[model samples]
Target: MSSSSQGEVVYTPQREARSAFPMAAILLVLGVGVLLPMALARGLTTNSELKVVALELCLLGTLAVLLQPFWGLVLVVGLLYVRPEESIAALAGMRFTLLVSLVALASVLAHLFLSREKLVRTPFNVMLLGFAATAILSTVPNWNMAEAVLEISKLVILVLLVLNLVRTPQRYRAFVTTLLVFTAYLALYSIYLYFTGGAMQQGELARSQATGIFSDPNDLAATVAAGLALALVRARNARGLMRLVYLLLAGSQVWAVVLTYSRSGLLSLLLVICGFLICSMRRKAISTVLAVGLGILLFVVAPSRMTDFDRSEASANQRFWLWSDGLQQLYGRPLTGIGYGQFPEINGGWTAHNSFVLCFTELGLPGYFFWMGCLYYCFKRRVPKATPEEESEEEKRDLVGARLALSGFLFSGFWLSRTYVPVLYLLMCLPVAAQIAARGRPGPQQVKGAEWLRDCGRIGLISLGSILLIQLMTDFLK
Candidate 1:
C-alpha cells in the first residue's frame, strides 16, 4: 500500500499493543461510576438545591482520590508510559476528544467506585469536585450538567493524558516539548492579533494589552506565562539537540509574552522568572541585580497598548455590577447563594473574570469558601521526593532544574487557577506525584479504616454536592 494511502501517521508495533488496555479500562469505569449516580438520583426534583447535590458528587468524586493515590499514580503513569496521542492518532481516531474526555471521567469514577483501591486518591479529583460544587444550586438551566460534564471531561483527560505520557523524566520532558510547540503557536497567534486584531488604542489604562485568540489580552498573556514556566524548566535541564531546542522555544515563548500587553501576566511571569533565579541558588547579590535589571527593562518596554489595563476601568466597572447584583441575590439566600452555575442566570453569563469572584457569584459564600479551602489544601501540600544518584554532576543539575520548573509553575499559578490547563496540570502534578511515588507512598500513612474514613468524609461532602447539582438540574423556574 502507498505510504500516503496508509496514512502519514503510524505507530510502532509496541505502541499499538499498550494503548488497548487503558482505553478499555477507562470506558468500563465511567459507565459504572458517573452515569450510575445520575440514574439513581433521577427521581430527585431539579431545583436550586439540586445543584448542591451535584456539587456533593463532585466533592465525593474528588475526595475518592484520597482513598487511592497509587491508583491515581497508575492512571497518571500509565498515561505517560503509553502516550497514545503521539504514537498513532488513529488509535483515538475521530473520537480522540471523547476518548480522552471519557478517560478523565472514567478515572474519577474508578476512584470513587473502586473501594478496594483506597490508595487511588488524587488531588486533581478533589479540585474537580470542589470546582463543580461552585455551580451547585444554580437557577440557571443545565448549568449543573454543563459544568459537571466539562469538569469531568477535562480533569479525566488531564489525569489520563499526563499520567500516560509521563512515565519517566524523559517522558515528562517530551510532554514539555509538546507544550513548547503549542506555545510557539500561541506566540505566532499573538503576533497575528497584535498587528491586526484590535486597533491600537492610546492613553488607555490597559495600554499594552495584547489580545490574541482569547479576545482578551490578559487571558492570552496568562496562557503564555504558563507555557513559559514549562519551557524554562525544560530548557534548563535539556541536553544536546533537545536542550538547544528547549532554550529557543522558551525564549520564543517569553518574547511572545512581552508582545501580549498583559500587566498581570507579565507580573506573574516576572515573579516566576525571579523565583526560579532565586531557587537556582545562584549568588544572591548577582541574582538580585539581574532580577532588578530585568524588571526595569520589562517596565520600560511594556506594550504601547497596555495603557488600557492600568485603570481597570472596564474590568472594575463590570466587576462592581456583577458583584453588587450577585450580593443582592446571594445575601437573600446567603447559605446556598444562587445555584451552582447560576451566575449566568444572574447577569447573562458574563463571568466574574477573577476565578475567586467567579466562585462567589455561582456558589455564594458557603460554597465559595469550601472550594477555596480545598484548593488551598492541594496547592500548599506538596513535598518533592528524593531522586537516585543526586551525588552525580548531571543529577544535581537535574534536581536543581526540576525544582526551578516547579517554582515557575507555583509562582505562575498565583495569577491563575491552572488546575485545568492540561499542560500545566501535568507539569505540576507529574513532579509532585513522582515525589510522592518515590517516597513509596503519598503523605503520612495511617490505618486502612482511617483512610477509609477520610475518603468517606470526602464522599459525604461530594454526595451532598451531588444533591446540589440535582437541585439545580430540577429548579422549577427553569
Candidate 2:
C-alpha cells in the first residue's frame, strides 16, 4: 500500500487481498454455542460457572484481537485505565490484564509482519528505547528487579501498540474518543463517589477517588486534568452536538479535579487551561473570558485545603524531605544511582514524590536524559508543515490536545512519582501517533550526531536547573 500526499492510504492488490476476516464473528458463535449449555447446567458450582464464563470471554477477546489488533489495543487500554480486577472480586484472580496485553502484542507483531507495514517511527523512539534499556541495566542490583522489569515491559508494549495500531486518522479519532469517554466515566464516577460519601479520606480531607490507577485522589485529579485539556481542544474544533458533548465532559473533569482537592491537581488544571488559551488561534477574547470564568468557578467550588501551601503542612513537608533524600542518593552515585524501583525501599518507605527526582536518583543521568528527552520531543512538532488547505483540522486538534495533556501530566508529575506510569507513556506517544496518522509515515529528518548532542546538552542543563530549583525550594521551606 502507498500513502497519498494528503495522507490517504492507497492499498495495493496484495494489501487489499488481506482485508479483515470474519474470524471474530465465527469465534463469537462458537463461544456462545459451547458456553450457553454449560451456563444453563444446574450441576455446575458457582466457582465453576464463573470460571467457564471467564474462559469464554477471554476466548472471544483473544479471537477479536487476533483478527483486528486495534480492538485489542483499545481493550488493553480499557483494562489498564478501568482496572476491573480492582472492582470485581472474580476478575482479581484471573490475570486478565497480562493475558490481554500479551495477545495484543502478538497480534500487532503478526499484523505488521503479514501486512509488510513499516513500524511507524517517531523522534522519541530512540530516547524511549534508551530509557527502557537504562531501566534494564539499572535493574542488576536493584532490590525490586522483577517490578522494574514488569514496569519497563508495560511501557514498551504501550508505546509499540500506539505506534502500530493508530496508523490512520479514523483510528486516531476513535482511540481519542475512547479515552475521552473513559475519562468522562471516571470523572462522573468520582463525582458520584464524593456525593455518596464513598470518597477516601486523607487526613481530615475527604477526597474523591476512582478505581484503578486513579484510586489516589491526586492521580485521579491529574488524569482528569489531562482529559479536560483534550476535551477543551476537541470542543474547540468540533461542531454542533459533538462540541456540546466535549464541553460537558471538560466541565465535568474540571469539577472532578476540584473534588479531589489535590494541590498539584489544581496546578495541573491551571496549566491545562493556560495551554489551551495559548495554543488557541481563534476567538482569543471570548476564550480568555471563558477561561477566567472557569478559573473563578474552580476557586469558588474548590475546597479550602486545595489552596493550602503552608510550610507546616504535613504532606508538603514530607515531599520536601523526600526530595532532599532523593537528591542525596543521586549525589552518592551521580552516574548510576541506586536502581529503578529502589527509592521507596531506601528512603524509609517513601517515594521521591517527584518524577524528575525519581529518574535522576534511580536511573542516573543517562536514564534521566532518555526520560526527559522523550518528554522534550513530545512538545516538538515533527510533522512537516502543510498548506492551510491541505492541513487537517482534526489532526491539528489532536496534536494540540496531546501537548496540552502532556503539559498537565508533567506539571503534576513535579509533585508525584509517576515515572513508570502507563499514562505517561501514552501521553508521550499521542503526538507521534497523530503525526503518523496525518503524514502516513515518519518524517524524513532524524536527529543525529551534532543535533543529537545539542539536544542531550539541553536536556542535561534542564535537569541540572530542575535539581537546583528543588534544592532551593527545600532549603527555603526548611
Candidate 3:
C-alpha cells in the first residue's frame, strides 16, 4: 500500500493480494498446527495434569517478567482487583501475594539499573519516602511489629511503584484506563449481585460487600465511588460514543454503590455527584432536584434497622463503642498509641471504623501527621496552573477527578477504616504524576518543601479538631 494523499493510505490490488497470501498461510498453519495437535494429542484432563499445566504457565509468566519488567507493574494492577488470594482462595490462596512480591522486586530492580532514566526526586517523592519512614518508625512501638512491617511495606512498595514508574501523561492515562476497565468489571458484578440478590447478608440488610481486597460493603462502595469520580471526569472530556459509554459506566457504578446499603458508600457517591455539579456540569437545578429526591427515597426505602439514630441497632452501637475505644486510646497515648493494626485487639475485635481514629490511635501523633500530610499535600498542592488554553483537557480532568475521588475517600473514612488501603494511596499519587507529566521535564516547579510542612501543621490541627468533634458526638450519643 501507498499514500495517495498526505495522511491517507491507498490500498492497491497487488498489496491486497500480497496481504491475502500471508493471511491464507497463517490460517493454513493454524488449522494444521493447532487443530491437528488438539485432534491427535488429547490434552491432559486430570487434576494432577492441570496442576502441571498451571506450573508450566507460571514458569512462562516468570520468563515474561524477566523479559519485560514494566509489564510486571501492569500485572500487579490487575492482581489488585482479582485478588487471587480471596477470589481463588481454594486454588492460589496467599500464593498471589508471593507472586506480587516477586514482581515488585523485579520491577524496582529493573527501574534502578536497567532503565536509563531515573526517577525524579520531586516533593511528592520526598513526601512518600517520609510517609514510609513514619510508618516504619511507628512500627517500633507496634503491638505486632512483624505484622505491621509486612503490611505497611507492601503498601509502601505499591505507592512507590506508581510514583516512580508513571512518569508521563500517557503512562498516567494508561493506568487510569486500566483501573477504570477493571473497576467496570466490579461494577457489573455488583449490579449482577443486586439483581440476583447474590450479595451477602449482614444484620437486616442484604449488602453487596465484596470478598478479597475489599472486605465489606463500605469498602466495595468506596471502590465504586472512586471509579465513579474518574468516570465523571473522563465522560466530561470524552466525545460522541465514548462519552456515552463512560456515562453508562458511571451510572452502573452509582447503582452498584447504592446496592451496597452502606451509608458511607452512598455519601461518597453523593460527594462525587456534587463535585460534578459544581466543577464541570453545573446542572444546579437538576442536582438540587436529584439530591432532594434521593434524600426522601433513602429515608422512605432504607431499613429502619439502619436509619434509626437512637442507637437501637447493633451496627450503630458497635461503631459508637469502637470509636469510643479508639478515641480513648488516642487520648491515653497521644504520642505513640496502641500501635498500628492493634485497634481490633483493643476495641472488642472490631476496627476503629473511622480512618482518622484509626490513624490517631494506631500510629499516634507522628504517624497521623505523616499520613495526613500525604493527603494534605495532594489536596493543597495546586495543579500546575497554566492558562486553560495551555493546559491539556486530559490533565485538567484527571486532577479534578482525583481531588473529587480523594474527597469521597476522606468522607468515607469517617465510617470506614481504610488508612492503609492501596487504592487511597494510588489516588493520592495521581495528581502528583499528572502535574509532573504536564510540566514535560524536570524543573523548580516540581519542588515544594515549605508547603508540605504547612500541610503537616494543618493536618495536626485537623486531627485535634476531629477528635473534639468525635468527643462532642460521643457526648451527644450518651
Considering every candidate listed, which one attains the maximal TM-score?
A: 2
Error of 2 at 158 (Å): 0.8
The sequence of per-residue lDDT tens digits that candidate 1 reaches over residues 1-478 is 1111110111111122344446545654674587556644652554435343533443343333333333333333333323433344333332333433454455544443442223233444454455555543343554456655565456545654444324344444454455556556666655665666442454543222333224455555665666666666666666799878877877766776676556566776776677656655569888887888887777777765443443346654465555456545655766666665556665776754444444554566556655544433333322224423322443344434444444454443433433334444445454433333222222233224554356446544653564455234324212
TM-score of each: 0.58, 0.88, 0.81
lDDT tens readout by residue for model 3, 1-478: 1111111111111112233344435554665566545533443443455444544444445445555454556767777776755755334543654575576556455545543444455555555666666666666754467776777777777766776666667777887887798788787886777678778777566777555756477888888898888898889889999999999999888878877777777778777887766677457787777766766676676555435556646677778777887778877888876777678876567888888788888877777777766776676644223353445766777888878888887788888888888778878877666655554443233323675465556778976776789877766663
lDDT of 2: 0.79
Per-residue alpha-carbon lDDT of candidate 2 for residues 95-188, written as tens digits (9 for 90 to 100): 7777888888887776666656556555577889999988888878755678777779888888988877887788888888878888888899
Q: Against the true structure, whose lDDT is highest?
A: 2
Off by over 4 Å in 1: 1-96, 103-120, 133-147, 160-167, 192-215, 307-309, 320-334, 381-431, 434-478
Clashes of each: 93, 0, 0
Q: What ranking emerges by TM-score with the best candidate at the front?
A: 2, 3, 1
Residue 106 lDDT in candidate 3: 61
Residue 19 in candidate 2, Cα distance off native in Å: 7.6
RMSD of 2: 4.0
Error of 3 at 282 (Å): 5.6
RMSD of each: 15.0, 4.0, 9.4
